[model samples]
Target: MQKILLFTLILFGIDSIFAVTHFLQYVYSGSSGIPNLPEFMTVGLVDGEPFTYYDSNIRREVPRQEWVTKAVDDDYWDRNTQVSMDTEPVFKNNREIAKQCFNQTGGIHTVQWMYGCEWEDETGATGALHQFGYDGSDFIALDFKTMTYVAPVMQAFPTKQKWDSDRARMDYLKSYFTQECIEWLKKYVSYGKSTLERTVHPEVSLLQKDPSSPVTCHATGFFPKGIVVTWQKDGVDIHSDVWVGETLPNGDGTFQIASKLTVKPQDWKTNSYSCVVQHKSLQDDIAVLLEEKNIKRTNQGGVSWGIIVGFVAAALALVAVVTGVVLWRRSRTGYGKAGTSDTDSENSSQQQPKA
Candidate 1:
C-alpha cells in the first residue's frame, strides 16, 4: 500500500513540473516600468522559448543559463527611423509614396516605417521609416528617413515558408509595439492588411462544348492562414458548384490555399468570372474574362468598307499617274530624242531646206 502511494505522488510531481514548465515557457509581460530596473522592459517567449527584453531606453536580451546582458546602443535605435502615428497624415503620405513606388516599379507587398507620434524620445523629432515592396517575386525595402534604397530581399523559402515567416514577424511586431511604444501604431500601420496580399494562379480547361455546359476555373496561391475564397459572376456572389481545397502550411511558415468553381458557359461568356479573397486586414478580388462568341459592335453604321476601298483606289491612281510622269521624263533626253531614229538623209534635207 505504501509503495502504491509513493508511485502516485511521483506521478503527480512530474505532472506539476510539466505544467509549470509550459506556463513559464509561454508567459508574456509588458508594462511601463519594472522594479529595480532603470528602464521599462517588454518580456515574452518565442515559440515557447524565452528571449531578451525590448524597451525604449534599454534593448537587451537575457542569456540562457548565464547571467549576461546583451545590450543594444541608443544610437542604434534611431528616432528618425520610426514611422508616423498621425493616422491620416501617415496614411496619406504612405499612399502617395506607395503609389509612386508601385508606378515606378510594379507593385508593393509591404511598407514599414517609424511612427512620429510614437517616438520613444520626448523630442518627437526623429524615427525610422522603412518600406517594403515586391515585384511579383523579389522583395524590396526603402528607408524613407534616409531616402536610401536597399537591395531586393529574395524570398529564400517557398511561398508557404515565406508567408509563415512574415506572419511570425507581424505577430512579434504587434506585441513589441503594444508593449514598448507609448502609443500603439498597429491601428495605422496596415500590417495585417499587407500580410493578406496574395497572388493566385488559376487554370481553366473546357470540359464540354455544349452551350449549357459549365466552365470551371481553378486557383492556387500562398495566403495567410484562415483566408476565405469565393467565386463571383459579374458583381454578384456565386454559390454553385464550388470546391475549396484544404490549406497546407509551407515548411518555413506560410500557407497555400486552392479553390475551384464551375458556371454556365453562356453566363461566363457574358459576365466576368472572379475570385474574391478576404482576410482580417485586407480584401481583394481577381478576375478573368470568359470568351464570348457573340459580341455587340459599338460603332454600328459609322464607317463602311466601301468608303475605305474607294479611298485606297483613288490613292493608287494618283501614285500610278505620278509614276508615269517620272518614266516619261526619264525617257526623253535633253535633245528631245528618245529611241527615235533620225535618218542622215532626213537631217540633211531639213538643214538644206532651212538654208
Candidate 2:
C-alpha cells in the first residue's frame, strides 16, 4: 500500500511527501478567443509554489519570489526572457496546429504543454514529464520507457510521427530532462532553501455548518505541504462517512487540508469522537474532540470571526492555485479522446524515446 501510494504521488507530480521530493514544473498555456486573459502564458513552479511567471501580456520572464530576485543575476533573467520569447511563437503555432487537427475553426480553444523534472532528495532518484494537451485534453506524451511518443488521440498521430522521426530531438529531450533539468532544480532548491526547507506547524479547526452537518477538521497555515487528517471513533480510525479535501495553498505560502466526518448527535454524545491530525513538524498528533464547545458553528451566535476568515482564506487560496495552473483540461467538454491515455501520472522510466 505504501509503494502504491508512493507510485500514485510520483505519477501526479504532487509534492505532498514533506521535503523528500521536490518538483520543477513549467506549464505553458496558449489560448484563442479568451478575452481579458493572456493569449500565451507560462508559469514555473517549484514544489507547487510558483517562483517565476511569463505571459504574452508581460512579454518578459519575471521573478515571483523575493528569493528568486535575489539569488539569480540579471543574465539569468535575460536568458530566460529570451528563451521564453523564442518559445512563445512555437506555442502559438502549436495551438493553431492543435486546433486544426481537432477540426476547430473558431470559438474558444486551448493548447497546454506541461513539462518538468522531479528530484528525490533522499534517494538521489529523478523523473521527468513532457506532455501536450489540445483543448485541455491529453493529446500526446513522451513515454520514457518505450522511448516513444504516445498519442492519446487520432489527431495527434501526425505529431507523434513527426516527433518520432526526429531521433536527435528525442535524445536532446532525454539529456536535457535528466541532466540539465536536475542541475537547475538543485540550484533553485539551494537558492530558496531558507524558504522552501522551513517547516511550519498547521493550525487546526473543527467546524460545523448546522446541527446535522458533518464536522470538518481543517488544518491551515502549514508548510512543506504534507499532512494527514483522520476521523477517530472511540479511538479507532473511521474511513466511511468521511470526505477528505485536497491539500491547498495559503496566501502566506503555507498549506491547508480538511476532512469531514458524518455522525449523529446521539452517537457523538455517547462515544468519544475526535479529529486527528498528523504532520511531520508535530511531536504528537493533534486530536480535537468532537464536541459542541470545541466546534465553530456557523449557525450559532457569538461565532469566532477568525474561523470564518480562515475559511474564506482557504477559498481564495484554492482560486490562486487554480489560476496559477489554469486547469483548463478538466473544464473542457465534448473533446473526443483518441488513443488510450495513460492514467498514470509520471512515466517512470528514464530512457530516451526510441525511433
Candidate 3:
C-alpha cells in the first residue's frame, strides 16, 4: 500500500506562511551606573540561542571568545574584527539611546530593536516591521511602523511638518541599521532551511458522527509546504463535507496540516473512503482507504461484520485455489510454483487508473 502523506479537516486554523520566520533583534541591558554595557542580537528566536552578533561601547564588555574560536579556524578572525571592532561603536550609541529610553520608561528593561519580514496565511500573508521594545514593559523605542517614537525622548517633540521631515530622515537612517543584523538574518535562515527532514505522511482515522463518522486526515512533518489532502467516498470526490487546514511549522522547520470530511454511516458500511494526499515530492497521491472489511462490530456505527465475513470466505477460497495449483505444478515438474499461478489470481487484480 502507498503511504499516507497528510491529515484531516476539522479546522485547526494554523497560521500559514508564504515565507518562514525571519527576525533581527538588537538588545541592551544596563544597570543604574555603568559606563560600559553588554551587547547582543539574535535571529529567529529572541536570545533563545547564542548571540548571532555582538558589539559593546567599552572593549572590556566584550565576551571572551576563546571557547568559541577554539573549534573554528583562523578565518574566523575576519568576522570577529568586523563585529567587535568596525561595528562596535554603532550599537554603542544605540545602546545609550536604548538605555535612556529604558530609564525614561521607569523599569529595569532591555531594549529590543527588531527588524525583519514574515508571512502568515491568516490575518495577513506577508509583512515586515522594524521597532524598538522594552524587555519587561509595554513601550516602544523607535516606532518604525509609524515612523515615530512611542515614549518621550531626550529631544523634544516636533511640529507636524517637522515630524514628517524628521521621519523621512529616520527612514533613510534605518536602511543602514542592519550593521550586522541583516547578514546574520540571512545566515540564520540558511542554516534553518538546510536542516530539512521529511515526516511520515498523516494518519487518517474515523469517529462515527451519529449518522456519519467525520474522517480526519493529518499530514505532518513535510517541508517546502505544498501538500493537498482531500477526501473521497466510493471513489468519487467529496466537497460539501470536506475542510483543509493551514500549514504550520513543526519547530524542526518541517510542516503539518489537516483535512477532514463527514461521511455517512451507510456509505461507510459498503464504500471505500480514501483520504488522498498529493505532494510534488511524491510520485503519486498516497491513498488510505477505510474499508468495510476492516471495520468491526456490524452494529457498532462504522462496523461492517457482513463484509468482513465475506472477505474472509473469499480469502479462504483463494488460498485453497493457490494451494491446489502449487500441488499440481509440483507433481508435474517436481517443483512448486513459487508465485501465484492459479486462475483466481486474475480475479484479484485491480484496475489501474489511466494517466
Candidate 4:
C-alpha cells in the first residue's frame, strides 16, 4: 500500500505540490497626499502564471496589462530614476525581470520584490525603496534609510577588486532610487488603505466528498481575504473526522474553501448538520443549514467548480491518504499511536497526497 501510494504521488507529480514552488511579489506604493502620486499598486507572480496586479484606488485585482497600459498611457514620466535612464526603460526592465525570475526560480522557496516610494509628511522627507529578495531574506535593498544599496546575498567591496562587478550597477540604482525616484514619489504618488476595506460576501454551499465520504461546506467569493468556515453538528462543534482544506484564492479578487466533516449515518439520515460561514463583510455569522435540497444542489454543481476548486479536491484526497492509511493500519493491527488522528495538522508536506 505504501509503495502504491508513493508511486501515485510521484506519477502525477502530486499536482498540488509540483506547482507553486516559489512565491514572487512586486509592490509599488507611495505615501498618501502627494500632488499626483499613484496609488499603492502591487503585482505578484506565482509559478510564472499570469501576473495579478492590484491598485489601491480600485478594490479588486486586475491583469498585469492594466498596469502596463497605465504605465504606457500616462507616460509615467512622473516616476524618477536616479540614473539617466527614463521611466519607460525601467518599467520595461521590471516587467521582463519578473517574467525571467518566475521562469528561473521554478524550485525555489520564495521571492519578494518591491519598486515603490516611501515618504514622511511631518518630517518632510522622502525616498525611493526599490528592491527584491529571495525567500524571506533580503537579498537586495535600495532604500533611503541608509542612503545606500546593499544586496545581503552579495559581499561589498573591501579590497576594491570587485569595483567593476554588478555592484557598479547597484550603486547607480541606489543613486536613482534615493534621489530621482524619491522626487517622483514625493511629487506624483500617494498611498491609501482602500484595499483593506474592499469586501465581497461569500456564496456558500455543501457538497459530499464522495458518495460515501464526509460532506464539505464550501464557501466562495468572499473578498479582502482571511475567511474561515467550520462545521457543526447538533448545535455543537465536532472536530473528529474533519478536514479543513486550505483557503485558496479565486484568481479574482475573492477567495474560497472547503471544510469537510464526517457525517455518520444517523446525522446524514436525520438532517442535523450545519455549516457556519464567517467573514468581516457579514454582520453576523451566516449559518447554512444542510438539508436534502442543499446536498442535491451540490450534486448538480458537480465537476463544474472542479476547475476552480481542484486544489480543494486534491486537499481532500491528501487528508484521506495521510489519515486513512494510518487508521487502516492501526485498525488492522489493533494498535494506535498517540496523537495519530491529528496527523493532518502535523503533516506540512508541500506535496498533496494522491487519494
Local accuracy of candidate 2 as per-residue lDDT tens digits, 1-355: 3333443464332435454887777766666787776777777777767788778888988877888886676688777777677666666666666565556788877666667777888888777767766665677777765668878667667667767777877788989888888888888888888888787888888888877888888888887777778899989998999998667656567777778888998999899999998877788999999988898885665334465456545533232233333343333221121121222122212222211
**lDDT at position 119, candidate 4:** 37
Q: Order the candidates by lDDT, highest first.
A: 2, 4, 3, 1
In model 4, where do residues sit more than 4 Å from their true spots? Answer: 1-195, 296-305, 310-355
- Model 3's lDDT to the true fold? 0.37
Better of 2 and 4 by TM-score: 2
Q: Can you write out model 3's per-residue Cα lDDT over 77-98, one digit (the tens) per residue? A: 4555453353334333443554
**What lDDT, from 0 to 1, does candidate 2 have?**
0.67
Evaluate all candidate structures by whole-model CA lDDT and list the values in order: 0.30, 0.67, 0.37, 0.41
TM-score pick, better of 1 and 2: 2
TM-score between model 2 and native: 0.78
Off by over 4 Å in 3: 1-115, 118-185, 189-193, 196-213, 224-226, 233-237, 249-254, 268-272, 292-355
lDDT of 1 by residue, 1-355 (tens): 3322322222222212112111111111111112432222222221112222333344333332111121223442242122111122332333344445445433222221111112212233212212222211222222232233333332312222333344445454344433443232222122222322232332222222344544333322333334455677776877878776543323222333445565665666677876665533233344444454322122344223343233333321121111122132223221111110111111111111000
- Lowest summed-lDDT stretch of 10 residues in model 4? 334-343
Task: Name the top lDDT candidate.
Answer: 2
TM-score of each candidate structure, all chains considered together: 0.23, 0.78, 0.37, 0.42
- Steric clashes per prediction: 25, 7, 17, 7
| Superior by TM-score: candidate 1 or candidate 3 | 3
